[model samples]
Target: MSSGVEADIALDAAVVLSLGMNRVLGRTAGLAGRGAEALAALAAGRAEARAAALAEAESYDQALRQVLERNARIEALAETREKLDAEVALPEPLRPEEQPIEELTAWCAATDQALDGAERRLSERLAAQVAAEIFAVPGGAEGLRADLGAPAPEPTENETYANETYRTLERVLARLLPDATADDRTAVAEAARLLAGIGSPEEAEGVITEVRLRVGEANRRTEELRARERRRAAERDAAEQAEAERQYVLGSITSAFEEMGYEVQDGFETLTAGEEGAVVLSRGSWPDHSVRLRVDDAAQVRAAMVRTAPARSEDDRRLDVEREREWCEAFEAARERLGEAGVRSEVTWRLAPGVRELPVSDGARQTGTRSAQRERSREREK
Candidate 1:
């Protein structure tokens, strides 16, 4: 019974330490365990037995605490690994299966910081791209940056109002630029260059208010000009705008494939009465495989894996299947690349691997279908 009490006291001390409490053996809270051990020693009245019991309790206490501490660390490391796994791909050495808990925790912190920096850089690049699209003329990203001038310094607390006011002015001026005269636009740009040095709201209010008045005047002149231009402009159908937008989107898609080192042939006809929009892309690496992008009237885009040459043997068939699988990966990557280029796309439908039905000779099928469609269109025109 005395030995049992001694063991229980030692276990209780370990429980306390496992809760991350301070070392309890020599402290006030440890008195109960220590007193029990001493009492057991005295009651047994055998020096050898007492020494053995003390050694046993001390060993149990140390072992139990170590186990509990290790368990806690393992639990924490596991949670960190799960979060990192979901956030980004784990590096080779930091992967949980590759190393122990201690090393993973140390490496994950660095990886998390690196991911943060990468995301920030990507965000800046996207912002710059958007700014170029809206503000720059064709091939004018660098010129637009020059026109916008250098970035303003961080505003002090006292200059917050002034800074926000300037930003508002800049946004409104940019929106009005399409209608404003070159001279008026230059005036606004010059004002922006000069105002970049001003910090006080009082000093900026006059220049900002003057810029606003100029923008309002420009808007009034634009309305008047549109009234005259409307009389001279021909009435156009809605399909014209839709076709232009479709062509623009197709151009972006073509650029994305070209950037991927594929040769693009965008024979995109206007989506008039019965036209089918198609683009073909091929790469030298896979001479026999080509990707056909089909855009219908509804503007839904789909990629077909085209086997330019028919398979003559079983080995050729196997190679064709492998090539199709590779095209699936490339098609998905192309969509992602389009997003980076500011073109958003969503997959409406896809046939999974081993489920797709491909024609024996896609090249022949494509040619016949396109020719027949054109012949029908010509008949209709006649």
Candidate 2:
């Protein structure tokens, strides 16, 4: 019984030891499984962290590329803006808040407005200059202000201010030089046309200068023509006055000769060689004797003379001498009569080639003898 109890105890002890060893082995296996699970979990976590880091790095690269592109575009726009500013000769167009497109649009709008305003001003200045030039022409300002009917209306959208001003100036110019030459009119018309279509202020100014020069040349020519016309008129007047004076002188001389009972020739002829202002006179009964009057440039009778034929015999010579004496006395009486009529003359007598000059008398010497002789000769002829 002791042995059996001991054996049972020993069996119980071995069983207990086995049970303890199994328990220990089971616990160790459980610890190893748990450690393997822990290690797998740690590796999975590390792989997830690595994937997250790669995704983050890729996102950062994309973001950096975008920033670089944006910076490049901005720099390009800035360079374009600087070039544009230099080209337009204006201030920097782009503001800090303006994008490239916005700044360009604003600049275009401002530039258009400025150009329009400048064109308008230049057009107005040109119009004024053209009007002034027109007014300077001869008879240009004749009632021009009063004749200008009314002001024109404003221009429409289709019409620019320059065109409107040009039209107005054209109207004024059309009426200005009514007597201008065809060439001058054509030149002015051409200049006006050029000025009307001018775009830039510089172009308009250059055209204005050219037009002014043309106008000046045209005016100079006009003035020259006017001077020529005046000279022609003066010449015509002088010629007329001279002709009138000549007619008056002729009439006076004719009247004086007709009052002396002599048949006077209408015009002067060269009776003697190298003699000027020699007038011949005749009577109805005296065929062999003649009378002459000498005149000066001033239409004044300088001298009067009686001429007789040459004697052929002694009796004829005596008669001729007597006739010459009678003629001298008659000439003296004629001189006295002319002096009373406000015409002073010197008496001369000519017999053959001999001439005798006598002083002018204020009173009659002996008119009865010559008068009786002339009366007898007239009665015999009748």
Candidate 3:
């Protein structure tokens, strides 16, 4: 294969790998849409020189893989730190910055164990509080045992065992209640109120059973809800980050053109505003010919040289193969400019110069008439 074709194949492989890795990272760590930045950086390095060797392509692949792996680790650490801050609420906030991966992983494991201990302590405290409230009432203890279908307590040892069992039940209920739905919580609250004012034996008998069942179902529903939310959050973050990166890339393209001495109008919103996507127009390069660039919704940019004024005859409208070849060179230069700014240009298809006799027309209006036409042509080819 030609070197150009080889380089294109290598770049395509890199993109495929990047996309696959991005999906894996999204599933594991909620990190997606980060591969674009790595690809752009790779393009910048490639721009140092277009090396045709297969070895250079292998180097690009290795560099991109390394970038993505390192980026995933860093972002994962940051996200874990934020989550710990929000849920654990440590007395002194953790400073996870600049920490090595091994150190961060160790810290996360240690903190997780500590959080388990803390939750156990809290559960015990809640159980104690419930016990105190129950004993404070005259027949509360007896009523609770009756509610759970346990026999009434005797003296001393049996009574102590009964008290401990009831406290354990309270602790279990408390642990699951946090993950319960609003309706489940309401049911628990109602049961608490009814238990507090138990004037009869029948009422106390079923309250505990009702609470246990409600919380059990609620816990399951809550798990599903949490998973769905996490997925949605990852998707949302990916989309927003993708758009931000695209805008940054678009801005770089605009700047690259401006640096090449072309006038750019920032016509990204042209179609909605009833104009075409004619972002750049050349001046003073050729008396009757000018180069124009149109960017579509997908941010694909096309450059073409056209007549400066309306063609007055059929010959005037005829294609100029020499000019077409010249414009191709200019287009390659534009891609190089984008590479300098750390953007990748993937040329999916191109028409060879002088191969087909196609008529040339007047340049696209900055207000966007012909630019839209070119955009449609590009879409059809795709």
Candidate 4:
């Protein structure tokens, strides 16, 4: 139960919780977060513009209403005048100043002109107002709720609802209490969940906070109990990585042996570790020349096999085979040319499934012999 291990476990739990929350937030917000962020930088200037547009729109609407009211009044007055013409007796036209029809017609025309101008201004103002509203949607934290496509996180009831709340509360509690055992944390989570769904947020927060503290304490205690487990797990992982790296190194060495025609078997005979599952595989015939091979545990080997596929692509494999064949071909050509220098040599170029070797049987000319004209060709072919 070391402190380092406990700290690592707590940190791991925190990382896991953070990743999950990030994904949840990402899914809920879409790209509105970017827009929300952009709005804040320009809010001050934009707020003034928005206010001006809104004020202009209200002024226009008021103007429009006033024009309509005035027009209605004029029309009503005209109707009254018409009724008066029919109901009351009027003298025959005689005085030059008593030109009622002309005056009434002129008054109607002037009111109509004013009404038209007011209506046009109102229309323009409404368009500006619409633009302002679009530009002035609440942003930052306010925008977050809109961006979530959520209903502002209302509390709920019912078993299913409560369960969801419990899970959410559990996550928060887990973040708050990284060291607690899973079971103890779950208990705290359930209590917090119940509190979340109850009526009144003030009361809910008060109740949940207590449960959260209790959960945190339990989580911390559980962490202490599991300290040994965490330490052992870390050690196991370190050992595995070290072992994997060593196995790769050995494979590299075997590759060098195989190039010299030694028929290197790599893990074929368990040459290095000499643990269980080691084999006595022989390559050369009769009074055989053999190389011992050893390897990590089979579980480690299998995991490596499954994981190593991604290190190469089909195209890479194809190119590698082409390159190897060219090398072997040049080596074979070099051996043939070596005989011309009063040097007789026997060389074989070969490749096989799961193995490849090029053995030269020239005892005297073996020194740096693979280097003669080796820059040009190798005989190994697919």
Q: Over the stretch 1-382, how does candidate 2's per-residue lDDT look in tens digits?
A: 0000000001111122222222323331111222233323434556565445444333333333333333333343344334323222222232222123344445545644654443333333333434545555565433223223346456567556554444545444533223345577568656755654567767766765666666667657866875786577557645643433333333444455567666776433335443454455666755555555545432344333333343346675455445556545555565544433223433232233223322111111234346668999999999
Please write out the lDDT profile of model 1 over residues 1-382, one tens digit for every residue: 1000000001222222222212322232222343245335645566676566555445544443343334333343344345323232322322122233345455556655654443333323322333444445554232234223367667788656655764565455544524345455555555544455555677667766766676677667766765664443323323433454455456656777888788987643233344356777788987666666765542566666666665558786677677777777777687766554334566655665545445533455676678779999999999
- Per-prediction TM-score: 0.32, 0.39, 0.54, 0.23
Which predicted model would earn the best TM-score? 3
- Cα RMSD of all models vs. native, in order, equals 29.9, 62.9, 11.5, 33.4
Q: Count the backbone clashes (under 3 Å) in each candidate.
A: 0, 0, 1, 19
- What count of clashes does model 2 give? 0
Q: Residue 123 lDDT in model 2?
A: 33
The total number of steric clashes, by the backbone 3 Å criterion, in model 4 comes to 19
The true-versus-predicted C-alpha distance at residue 267 of model 4, in Å, is 5.4
lDDT of 2 at 9: 7
Residue 103 alpha-carbon offset, candidate 3, angstroms: 4.7
lDDT of the candidates, in the order given: 0.50, 0.43, 0.48, 0.35
State in Å the error of residue 364, model 3: 7.2
Flag clash pairs in model 3: 276-368
Cand. 3 Cα-lDDT: 0.48
**lDDT per residue (tens digit) for residues 30-141 in model 3:** 1123344445545656633333322333444444434343444334434434532323232232443323445545555565565555444433343334444544567655
